[model samples]
Target: MDFEKLLVWQRAKALTVSVYKEMAACPDLVFKSQITRSALSIPSNIAEGMERFTARDKCRFLRIAKASCGELRTQLMIGSEIAYVAEPLAAVWIIETRELSKMLNGLINRISD
Candidate 1:
C-alpha cells in the first residue's frame, strides 16, 4: 500500500503541520522542538515501515511510529499544563494522537493476522 494513501499517515502529516504552525510562536525553543520532532516522527516512521519487505519489519516501524505518537501526546500535555499551548488546542491534538494510535493498532493487527 502507498504510504500517502494511509489515513493514519495523512492524519499524522496533518497533525505535524498543525503542530508546526501552532508551535511556531512558542517562546520555549526546547518544548517547541520536542513537540515538533515527535510529531514529525509519526509519519516518517510509518513511511519507513511501509517500505520494509517483511510484515515483522513493517510492524516494527508502525510500533515505532505509535511510540512517537505517545511521545508527542506527552509533550502536548506538558505544553498545555505549562501554558505553552492552550488547553483547547492541546485537547484537539491529544484526540488526534489517540485516533492515530488506534489506527496504528488496527494496522498492526491486520499485519499480524
Candidate 2:
C-alpha cells in the first residue's frame, strides 16, 4: 500500500502542519526543535517503514511512529500547561495523535496477521 494514501498518514501530516504552525510563535529553541522533530518523525518513519521489503520491518517502524505520536501528545500537553499553546489547540493535537496511533495499531495488527 502507498503510505501516502493511508488515512493515518494524512492525519499525521495535518497534525504535523498544525504543530509547525503552533510552534511558530514559540521563542524557545529547544521546545520548538524537539516538538518539530517529533512531529516530522511520525510521517517520515511511516513512509520509510512502508518502503521496506519486509512486513516486520514495516511494523517496527510503525511502532516507532506510534511512539512518536505519544511523544507529540505529551509535548502538546506540556505546551498547553506552560501556556505556550492554548488548551483548545492542544486538545486538537491530542485527538489527532490518538487517531493516528489507532490507525497505526490497526496496520501493525494486520501485518502481524
- Candidate with top lDDT is 1
The 10 consecutive residues of candidate 2 with the worst lDDT sum are 10-19
Q: Pairs clashing in candidate 2? A: none
How good is model 2 by TM-score? 0.97
**Runs off by more than 4 Å, candidate 2:** none
Best by TM-score: 1
Error of 2 at 103 (Å): 0.8
| Candidate 1 per-residue C-alpha lDDT over 22-46 given as tens digits, one digit per residue, 9 for 90 to 100 | 9999999988888899999999999
| C-alpha TM-scores of all predictions | 0.98, 0.97
Model 2 residue 6 distance off true place after TM-score fit, in angstroms: 0.6
Model 2 C-alpha lDDT per residue in residues 1-113, reported as the tens digit of each score: 89999888888888888889879889998999999999999999999889998999999999999999999999989999998889998998899899889999999999879
